[model samples]
Target: MTTKRREACPNLEANLEACNCSYEPCGRKGLCCQCVAYHRRAGQLPACFFTEAAEQTYDRSFDRFIQTWS
Candidate 1:
C-alpha cells in the first residue's frame, strides 16, 4: 500500500474562510484534498458537500446528502 503525504495546504487560510465544516477539531479542516479522500474512503461525503445546516449535523453519509437535497 502506498502512503500519501500530508503537505501544508497553500490555500488553507482562504479555504478556512469558506469551509462550513462544523467539526471543531478536525485536522483535515482546510485541507480539501485530504478531507475529500478521507471521506471518500469511508463511503461518505465531506462536510463541504453539505449545506451549512446539514453540515452541522455532521452526518457525512451519502444518504444524508441526498436527504438534504430531497
Candidate 2:
C-alpha cells in the first residue's frame, strides 16, 4: 500500500488553475499528489487525464482513460 503525505501543497493556485475536475465536493481537487495516488491505488486514472466531456462521466478506469485518449 502507498502512504499518503500530509504536507501542504505549495503550488495549489497553479494546480487549481490547471485542474478540470468537476467533482464539487472533492477533497483532492487541487492536491495533485493525493489525487494521483488515490486514483492509482484504485487502478484508475485521475480526472485530469480525461477530457471535459469524458470527465463528467466520472469513469476513471484505465480502460476509460485509454478510450478517451485513443
Top model number, lDDT: 2
Q: For residue 22, what is the lDDT in candidate 2?
A: 93
lDDT of 1 by residue, 7-32 (tens): 37667778888988989888888789
> Positional deviation of 31 in candidate 1, in angstroms?
0.5
Candidate 1 lDDT (Cα, whole model)? 0.84
Kindly provide the TM-score of model 2 when superposed on the true structure, using C-alpha atoms. 0.86
Shift in Å, residue 27, candidate 1:
0.5
Model 2 segments beyond 4 Å from truth? 1-7
Give model 2 RMSD, 1 decimal.
Answer: 5.4
lDDT of each: 0.84, 0.86
Best by TM-score: 2
